[model samples]
Target: MSKAIDHLMKVHRPKQKIQNNRLRSVIVSIYLTKFVPCGDPANANGGRWLLTFGSPDMKLDDLWQETLLGMIGDCFSHDSDPQPLSRFITGCVVSIRVRGHKMGLWLSEAQNPNIVREIGRRWKSMMNLPSTIRIQFETHNESGSAQQKPIYEE
Candidate 1:
């Protein structure tokens, strides 16, 4: 997406709404319809969303920008893996819910733990989070289903 489109679509949350911290129904609908696809892990796992819960002290947009900037930088990093997995990161989302805030990095697959972990590590580094900070990987199938739990986490 273009920066103009991104800026237009990017959420600008208010203080009150941030304090509420509830994932709005509109956002959920958008994720379900626009991002998450329908199918099996092998066929549809082409993309994954790396989800990280933000610290209570951090603002949603700040975390989003940090993680996003990190992803963007990695995309152009010079010292790189011969077969890079970061190429799969298509975009990101910063969500505020009643429980807390979350930043999701959208990837192109969920089957490879190596790629997933690498992405998670990059995300943690970018956000300046600790190693223990949990990052969850959820496939479109798992995310779309009401009963299934997330596919993986690191």
Candidate 2:
């Protein structure tokens, strides 16, 4: 994934008869001190909330914007908790796949299921995704070819 790439929202994909067939992934990495792959200390224990849109739509832009704004604008917080959930978030990504586009929100801790689940719940709301739409929470570590179960979902 590209680190700290700008204008990711503006990056257009090649026209396709079926929009879901798009191949290239658009990644937007948000970091605290440095890039993740470059050994950013902040992401040592990071994980991400992954949302896959089976069918891309006009709302995709709006959903992404809301997430980015929530992170940079410090608008995320759990009930009765003054700590901003964004503090744990490291970055996000939008990866295009043959069947759909995957949007991921990276967070700094994977061990805390409460925080992780809370973030997922907030993101589902932030994106206005209905109960029909389910998202996954997974660690940043690659599990190789083995399929790892989602740690949590919301």
Candidate 3:
């Protein structure tokens, strides 16, 4: 199963590191935190966050990984003239729980209105999100509060 997933994501399979399920979760959490962006200007504005809410039986964790891999592949399909915006992708995450599932895409800059909007548009296209859904971008400062509001909505 792990090998199949690795192939689908176009990533080298990681060797099992822990026997205990709880300990494995802790180790994975630590590994994931290493990708958090630094406070440099390129990343200071935070990044675009796009989430996909899927039904409980959608197995969205797998779906998110597959979608990300597919997007990455599409970005580089031009060989020598790949899209510039692809470079802005910083990280992505998927969360699946008893209630539902969500996937997030994190980019490097959210300050440029044009770039942000383009990224959002391309993302919706590449991910093939349903036409009924509207994408939005929320800056870090604008998202931390209890009554957080998005900076822009499409």
Candidate 4:
């Protein structure tokens, strides 16, 4: 009976392609931070804030570029709807503030977000998490910014 069960299991095993897809679909939580200029010289030369999102199944680097391009598209002029920034947003300099993790690419004013809300909304959707994901866009400004300054620290 044990031999028969083993044979049945082997016969029912899935192929490699099926296994790969299943693996790829598995949800993976990744922490991502997007920095946008806030238009303040004291806070910095440009107006910007740091927005953080938790994503699943998306690569960190790819998501970073996507988030940047999405923000830039929302603010500046893009040739097309999808926009050309999709390619340019990648391979830019990013400075990550998280401890023990010296990661990120620094995107220029042409790359960072002029509109913070658009970026925040996009980030939340990209995460694709089943649960309600909280995305916060934080900048160092007293008032008149697109979004409010984050009171709670990550």
Candidate 5:
């Protein structure tokens, strides 16, 4: 009876470890998805827009650049009006959360124009904001009409 109990414990230990690892992986994946802005708006007004990339391993600025380029590409393909896209996206606030190996992003309306315009211009889309609004970036790079900057301030 003692020998049988020992064998069962040994078998269960490995299975438990595997289950724990799997759970950790799932948690990490969920975190990553949250960091990226991938979801439908609550009002069902516009199509899904995923702008933020939620991993600490990934740079938010670079992800913004890529997202802008991708959106521009999409616009080019669909030939949609750039003005409305600029207005809608500029008014959005994206929240990205990343901890250790996990990340997540959430998007909603933003009251600040600086935040909106900074993110909007990355897509080469223009925004009209009040003159009282102030915009700042830690790093700014411009190549032709393409501009890039970090979305979050350090």
Candidate 6:
């Protein structure tokens, strides 16, 4: 990807103009999911388990890769559940920001605290996060709204 970016930059750097806002960055998002709309019965409610980093951490890349693999690779399954816990996962996102970086695990249900919290706990363990870092689960209903708040944290 870096090589491709370098090639693109080499080709466009000479013609670079402020008017065109293209090919400015690397990867934007990695969304993993099966088809299911907002109205789908399979997803009655939805939320995201959010983990924020103060600055770009050395482990960010590995954590993101691990999280991506855990979700799509069925690493969340255990003895307690009949199905893989990842079944409830709708998608995952990692956002790069100036203030902090955020890793989100979007889920199919937010109304159920049991599984939601369980996922949060497992997520912390998966990332091997220190206790100092807290991961919060915020319902989609609350995201970017006045009511935006985390219902669960680990």
lDDT of each: 0.56, 0.68, 0.54, 0.34, 0.31, 0.69
Error of 1 at 151 (Å): 3.3
Model 5 residue 68 CA deviation (Å) reads: 2.7
Question: Model 3 — which ten-residue stretch has the worst lDDT?
Answer: 24-33
Per-prediction TM-score to the true structure, in the order listed = 0.64, 0.75, 0.63, 0.32, 0.22, 0.74
Candidate 6 displacement at residue 69 in angstroms: 1.3
Off by over 4 Å in 3: 1-35, 38-42, 52-54, 57-62, 74-83
Candidate 4 lDDT trough over 10 residues, lowest sum: 97-106
Worst 10 residues of 1 by lDDT: 25-34
Candidate 1, after superposition: displacement of residue 144 in Å?
A: 4.1
lDDT of 2 by residue, 51-72 (tens): 8777756366677767776776
Poorest lDDT segment (10 consecutive residues) of candidate 2: 9-18
Top candidate (TM-score): 2
Model 5 score (lDDT): 0.31
Cα lDDT tens digits, model 4, 1-154, are 5563454334311223235565332222112134333332322422222333333232444544444444444333245545533332222222332221112222222224533344334344653423443543333343245666643221
Superposed on all Cα atoms, the candidates' RMSDs to the truth, in angstroms, are 5.0, 5.2, 6.2, 15.7, 18.2, 7.4
Per-residue CA lDDT of candidate 3, range 1-154, in tens?
5554465555421112222233222111111224544454555676656564645444344445545564545451333533566666666655443344445566667777766777677666666667786666777555556877777666
* Predicted candidate 5 versus true structure: per-residue lDDT over 59-102, tens digit per residue: 44343333433433333222344434333331122333323321
Off by over 4 Å in 6: 1-27, 35-44
Per model, how many backbone clashes are there?
A: 4, 0, 0, 12, 6, 0
lDDT of 6 by residue, 44-73 (tens): 578889887775544666787677667656
Candidate 2: segments with Cα more than 4 A from true spot: 1-25, 37-39, 143-145
lDDT of 1: 0.56
